[model samples]
Target: MQSSFSPLVAISPIDGRYQKQVNELSGYFSEFGLIRYRVRVEIEYFILLAEKGIFKMPAKIKPAQLRAIYEEMSEADAQQIKETEKTTNHDVKAVEYFIKDQLHQLGGDEVAEWVHFGLTSQDVNNTAIPLLWKEAVEESFMPYLLNLIATVKEMARTWKKIPMLAKTHGQPASPTTLGKEIMVFVERLQNQIDLFGYVPYAAKFGGATGNFNAHQVTFPKHDWVAFGNEFVNERLGLQRMQFTTQIEHYDNLAAHFDTLKRINTILIDFCRDIWTYVSMEYFKQKTKKGEVGSSAMPHKVNPIDFENAEGNLGVANALYEHLSAKLPISRLQRDLTDSTVLRNIGVPMAHSFIALKSIEKGLGKLLLNETKINADLENNWAVVAEAIQTILRRVKFPQPYEALKDLTRGQEGITQKSLHKFIDGLDVADKIKNELKAISPQNYTGVEFDY
Candidate 1:
C-alpha cells in the first residue's frame, strides 16, 4: 500500500503502459479488492450463523449496521488490514481480527468472537475469490466480448454481398462473399462463448480438508453439508464443490481458464486473418491526424491495433493455459503453490481485457477496400473452375474434375475467353456448356449465408 510506483515505474505493462485499458479489473483482483471481498464474505458468514440459530444476537447490535460493513469499508480500513497482516503473517486471520475489532466498536464485543468461527482460511478465500471472478466476468469482461462479437456481426452484414477470391493453401481456389468469410469467425466464437456459460463458477466451502470438520464437531447435529450447499449456492451465488482437500480442487476454475484460452486462441486466429487482409489491400486503416505509423516513413499506416491484439492475446492465452494446467493439480491435502498462483489469476484477465479493447479498436478503424476486393474477384477468373466442374459432375460429364484440372491447374492466365472457349469445345450438350460459361468468378459465390 506504500506509494513508490507510478505507471512509469511499474514493471508489468498491465499496471503501467496499459493500466487505463485494464484498470476496470482492479476492483475485483487487486490486493485491496481481495481484502474487501474477503471481509464481505466474513461478515456474510457471521450473519448466516446468526440466521441459523447458532447464537443469539447481541442486544447492543443493529443488523442494519452489521450488513453495512462492506459498503462502509474505506481505503483506510483496507490499509489497516494490511498492517494487521504484517504482524499476523496470515491474511485471512488478519481479516478476522479486523472484523472483531469492528464488532467491538459497534457495541457488540459480546459476539465479536463469532466472526470467523468454524471456518478455515480457504472457506473465506475460495468463496471470496470465486465471487469476485463471477462478478468481474459478468459485469466487466462480457461487455467487451459482446462488443467485439457485435462488431463482427455488423461487418458480416455490411460485407455480405461483396465477392472476393478465396485462398486455399495459398492459391486462388473458389469465390466467397466477404461477409461469409467474416461470419466464420463469428460462428466459431459464438459456439465457444455459449459453452462458457456452463462452466460452473464453483467454490470449496467445507472447512480445512473440505469436510466441515469444525462446524460438525461444534454443533454435533447441525446438517452442516446442507448448510454449506445452501450458503454457497444461495447466499454466495457460487457453486459449492461437494468435496475437496484443504483447498478447492479448482477443477471448475481450471475449466473456466481453458475456456478462456480457447476464446483467446480464436481471437488470435481472427487477428492474423485481418492482418493478412490489411496486408493484401483488402482493408485499409483510418488514421489519426497526428499519429505516426513509422519513425522514418511518411506514407505507412500500420495495423498496430491488430498487432497489439495478437500480442496481448498470445500473452493472455499463455497464462490461461498455465492456470488450467497447474491450478487443478495439488499435493495431497493441498500445497502453498496454489495460494501464490491464485493471487495472480487477475493477470491473465487484465491482459485479455486489454486485448479485447485492442480488437474492438481495430475493428472500428477498418475501412473496407471494396475496389480491391472486386479487383481480386475479377483477376482470379480461374476460381470459377470449381463451380463449372461441379455443374459438369451434376450433369454426368466424363471426368469433370480432371477436365477442369487440365484447364485451371497452375495455369498462368485463364480468362473469361479461355474458359468460354473450352466450354465451346466441350462435347457436352449446348445447354450444359452454356450454363458452365455463365459461371464467373464475380458471380460464383456460394449460396447466401447469414447468422
Candidate 2:
C-alpha cells in the first residue's frame, strides 16, 4: 500500500523518531485503537443488556453470528468510523452511528436504539480508555518490565561474589559485591512492580454529571448503579467509580501515572549507576561491528546506551508527572483539557518503552571487568579500617575506633602490608594480631554475597 503521511506531521517524537519501537502499542492507543475499544464497549454493553433481560434479544444470537459482530470489526471498520467522524466532528457520535449501522445489518434495527442506551461520550471514553490501558499494561508494559527485572536478577546472581570498591560522594568508601549492588535495583524494581500490579484500573460509568440522571429519569425501575458496577468491573475488567462529573474524576488514573513515574525514576537511577560503573572501567561495553561510538575519538567506547536510557526515562517521567497532575483536576463538572491531555498518555509510555529497550541493550553489552574490580579493591586498602576497628572492639581494646582512624584515615597507599605491619606493632596479643591480619579489602565486603 502507498502510504500518505498525515497532512500535519505529529509534533511529538512518539509518532516521529521512536515510533517503530512503540508501534506495538498503536493497537491500544491510536485512533484505530479508540475505535476498536468503542466498538468493544458497545458490543459488550449490548450483550450485557441482553443477558440482564433489559431488552428482549433475538431468540438466539448464534455463537457464529455473535462472533461475526465482534470478529468483523477490523481496521476497515475503524476507518469507516473515522470517515463518519469527519462529517459529525464528534468522535463518540461517530462510534454510536457506526455501531447502529452494524446493528441494522444484523437485522436488529428494533434494538439499535439501545446501542449506547443512556450514556454520555465520557461513559464510552472512560471505559474504553481504561480497557485499552489495561490491555497495554498486561500485554506490553508488564512483560517488558518483568523481563528487565529478570535480566537484572540474573546479573545479580552471576556477579554476587565479585567484590568491587564502593563509592560514596564519588569517592571510594568501602567494598561491596557487584551482585549486591545489582540486587539493590532488582529489589527496588520488584517492590514497585508489586505496587503497580495492585493499583486498580478504574473507570467512571454513570451518565452525564455522574448522577445517572438521564438513565434514572428514563428507566427509574432499573438499578443503574448495580448495572454500572457489573458492566465496568465484570465485563470490562475495570473498577467502576460510582460518582463522577461529565467525565471520570481520573484520581485512579493519576495514581497509575504517578506509579509509572516512580518506576521510571528508579530506572533512571539504575541507568546512571551503570553508566558511572562503565565510565569507571568496572564494566566494559561489547563492541558491535560497524557501530561508531564517537565521530572523532576512534578509541571511545562511550556509555551511550545508558545515556540514551537515562535521557528517554527523563522525558517519560516529565510527561508522566504532567499527566498525573493535570488529569485529576478538571474545571467544575468537566473540561476539554483532559480530553486533549489524555491522548498523549501513550507518548510518555512509548518513551518509557524506548528507555527500557535501551537499558536492555546496554545490559546485554556489559563485559564485567573483574581485573579492574580486583585492582580497585587492592588499591583502596583504607577500606579495611572498618573491619579492623570492629575486630579491635571485639577484643575490648581501648579507643579501637580512634586507633584505626589514626592508622588508616587520610592515609593514601595504605596497602595490605602497611595495615598488617600496623597490626603487628599493636600491644594486643598474637591471637589479636592474627585475627586482624586476616582482614583485607577483598574480603571486607561483609555478608553481601551470602545469598
RMSD of each: 1.5, 2.0
Worst 10 residues of 2 by lDDT: 1-10
Q: Given candidate 2, what's the lDDT at residue 85?
A: 92
lDDT of 2 by residue, 1-451 (tens): 1125552476877777776788898888887777788778878887888788888887645435644655566777778888999999999999889878876777778888988888899999999999999899899988999999999999999998888899998888779889999899888888888888787999999988898898899889999999999999998999998778989878888888888898999999999999889988999989989999899989989988889989999998999999999999989999899998988888888999999998999999999999998998999898988888888888888998999899877778899888888888888999889988887788888775554
Writing each residue's lDDT as its tens digit, candidate 1 over 1-451 gives: 3334589988999999998898778889999889999999999889888989988878668677887778777778998999999999999999999999999889888888888888999999999999999999999998789888998999999999988889888888788888999999988888988999988889998998898888888998999999899889999899999978889988889988988889999999999999999999999999999999999998999999989988998998889888888998889998888889999999989988988999888989999998998888878888888888888888888999999899988887888888899889888899898788878888898799745
Segments of candidate 1 deviating more than 4 angstroms: 1-5
Question: What C-alpha lDDT do the candidate models reach, one value each?
Answer: 0.89, 0.86
- On TM-score, the candidate that comes out on top is 1
Candidate 2's C-alpha lDDT?
A: 0.86
